[model samples]
Target: MALGGCANAWAAASSASLPFDDIAGSFAKNEIVELVEEGVVNGTGNRKFEPKKNVTRAEFVAMADRLLKLAPVDADMPSFADVPAKSWYYGWIEAAVQLGIAEGKSKSSFEPSARITRQEAAVLIVRALKVDPGSDTGSGLDYKDKSQIAPWAAPYVQAAHTLGLMGGADGKFRPVDAMTREETAAVLDRILHDNVWSKAIRQTPNMGLQLGWQNGLTTAQFKEQVKNSAVNTLVPRWFFLEYGSTPVSNHADPSLSSWAKQNNKKVWAMLGNHSDSALTHQILSDGHARAAVIQKLAGYAKTYGLSGINVDFENVNPEDRLSLTAFISEFGTSLRAAGAVLSIDVSPDLGTDWTEAFDYEALGRYADYVVLMGYDEHWDGDPVAGSVSSLPWVQSALNRMLSVVPAKKTILALPFYTRDWTLQSGGASSEELTLIQQGYRIRSVAYNRSWDSDLGQYVVSYMRQGSQHKIWVEDGRSLGLKTMMAAKRGVAGYAYWYVGAETDEIWTSLSNAIRYASY
Candidate 1:
């Protein structure tokens, strides 16, 4: 976990991963170093960043594509006269144009090799951030060189400066000067760690606390089991975002916060999007709606004394990938300003509506923690019956996530339930089985069981109703072993899916594993 003390040894190590041989003593050295760690920008080769080199239209497009994870776009012919299908940056240019972020030198010419000026860069960045141009076009500028800015580009330049995406030197806007590689990196760094983002003190903290989510449980029902469980951080699925400018609470429970305050536990309220992609698009794309939700969520966090917020937006449209990134950055800034941490839930990077919108690298930078939903290796939709979250699958997914997200900022979410897979007629279907229910089922049926050492789980099989039933059991033993394995990776912490689904022994096993693992 590299986020120790927020920016500790791990951060230092990551920064050194790209030791640009030429950036020493440059004004943008720190910014260059930071972007390198995020895997957003790179050197020119031979360990040199060529910080003073000028950026071209094509070069800027490539860098912006990596930072935004823009959706791919295809074209039957060239997107422009200069941007041909054979070029390395053809798709990125097409995306830039179709996504409404870029412009061409002429009606037919993109001038891919032409140097881009600072004002042009500002226009592109403001468009890419998806914010409308400043309405009071003539009032936003204060730079000494403001007069030099093109009249047509004044609004975008004003918006870019107001958003802190671009700045001037010696109060000079330098609108006509070309942006250097180092200057470009500074802009990207500001995007990742904006003025508001500096308020986020705990990029990753207190990974030792045992965490669990709560849904559909009253205070009385939850307290009964939680009082004796190993859990210390409680995340309630309480808030929600609805269509257009109106966000709803979905009946948020305040008693849970009362309990957390009295019990020496922490509370992080969860916000869901109802898996509605169009609605989410409205929130992310509309500046007013996005700000309202951030304001409302931040107010709720403050009012409820929430230690953090757990975002569980799922089934998002992939086209909203960059928009989601922008929202998280803004929302997290607001949450941290209100003294709440931001932890976003993400599925393993795969081909599902639930997983497509997330760009892990961007999310990791925007949120304090990235909770990897380390389950659903073999979902109910799969034709084969297998472990809901096999040990190998969890291990692989966690490792892949750590490559982009810092380990200290990554949380592994464990499944508190498994599946009773039924195989018949060359098709397979499965029933979700809670930890306690699986234990009961194993006792009632004649089962053949064995430990798959490689998977770190118990494989059980039984025959009933003329079909073979296979259960990759998730019990205290298996879960404990999985915890121990994850601990070795130095992840920030672990979190289970939901509360009230497991027996008391599961907590005991997990607590011991978390405490005793030799990390």
Candidate 2:
């Protein structure tokens, strides 16, 4: 009989025959069929599913075991007084308990024969998925009997509802009511086919750009240029800290926000500290100051009709690492409640004084998107000259970053501008130049611009004022290659360091490159 039951379980999972006769033309017929095909649901006996029968705790455990492909536990039999060692559900119940997907009715009583409730099933499924529903007590549920849901199971129920695993009837979520076989099958089918995490990972590509307030571009010009580019999100420098405790607005160009809304683009208010270590440490180290900053940023997002806030606090002290993490966590909670996104920008991992303070893993967990400043391989103050962002350098940095953060939550920040270094006697002083400006300077000097395959950029060397000037150009070709690299790595998307730094021709090239790459 045990062998026969095992054979039936396998057949129910692999065979497509309609074993349940009563489910024909029922609302859950298709779901029942799929679950049977997936081996997650089996008939009670003699090829009969008993669709309307109440599912028992043991039966639900068996279904969860099959659906999750959980490994069977090989320990001594459970001490539940009612569950005998030879029971058919003994192995599955033990496995479920080991996986933390289910618990006994009491320390000594499993009550395996008792009917399972809707909320109970939800809690089991939530535990199986290993999702953190957080500590938000209020269920955003609109069900009439939501108040009756057990406090411990509220978050799980809400999570299951959000994932489309369960639903209510007649504006009521009968939390304590027994779940039927058909309902259980439907829920399992949804869990198998509709994964919420995978859906979030494959969401729309988010191409963005940071706009400096001092870029000197008018609203009309900004709109005309950005609308034609592949930018979907615009982070304009708008707010900063006042005395390290309050937020002050720079008030972006009035027309910028309206234009973004009309063009189906989102504007995120940029909150910057401009590398002020003292100010950043002050606000982050204080609990009240951190709360004030979060509140003020949320208020700004609401007042400006912005989609989110871009946190650009740089040059943070190493001691403030935990404090910064706390601020981001609290800030993220507030932004989530306000229906806004939270994106954070961090420097590259170079083991330098500036980048070592950031906690990449914590920021990845708290922020919707973690933007890596992937440029400035050789900054303006560097002693030696190198590519602004070489392909090898950026790739190495990305690999280091991915070790701590997930690719789906990471964004690569590319530079639209390059640096021109002048080799002088005392020290090398470099000037930041755009792609257009670099091209113009090269042409004016009539210097032969050659492609450096290693750097993936163009290089030009000329002698002016008795000093050798060299520049590694970031034109359309280099930008396209970097964008493709980001896409191939399966990252969220790429963003430009700032607007008004690239030529008109580069925009079309970038748009085609990103669009064709299917990012």
| C-alpha lDDT of all candidate models, in order | 0.79, 0.76
Write the residue-wise lDDT of candidate 2 on 1-519 in tens digits: 999999988766654457675676457888888878767788877667888899999999889777765433322323366777678887677666543467778766889999999999998888877677776553598999999999988998998888788999999989999999999988877776766533532354344343332245666766766765667787777788768224454666656777788878888778888778888888888898888888888887776778888888887888888998898889989998888989888888888777767889999999888888889889978988878898778888888888999998888988878988898888787999876677677767845455566877667788888888888877666776677677777888777767777766566445434443441
Strongest candidate by lDDT? 1
TM of each candidate vs. truth: 0.59, 0.58
RMSD of each predicted structure = 23.0, 22.3
Off by over 4 Å in 1: 1-207, 351-353
**Count of residue pairs whose backbone atoms collide, per candidate:** 1, 1
Report the CA-based lDDT of candidate 2 relative to the real structure. Answer: 0.76
Sequence-dependent TM-score of model 2: 0.58
Model 1 residue 163 distance off true place after TM-score fit, in angstroms: 62
Q: CA lDDT of 390 in candidate 1? A: 87
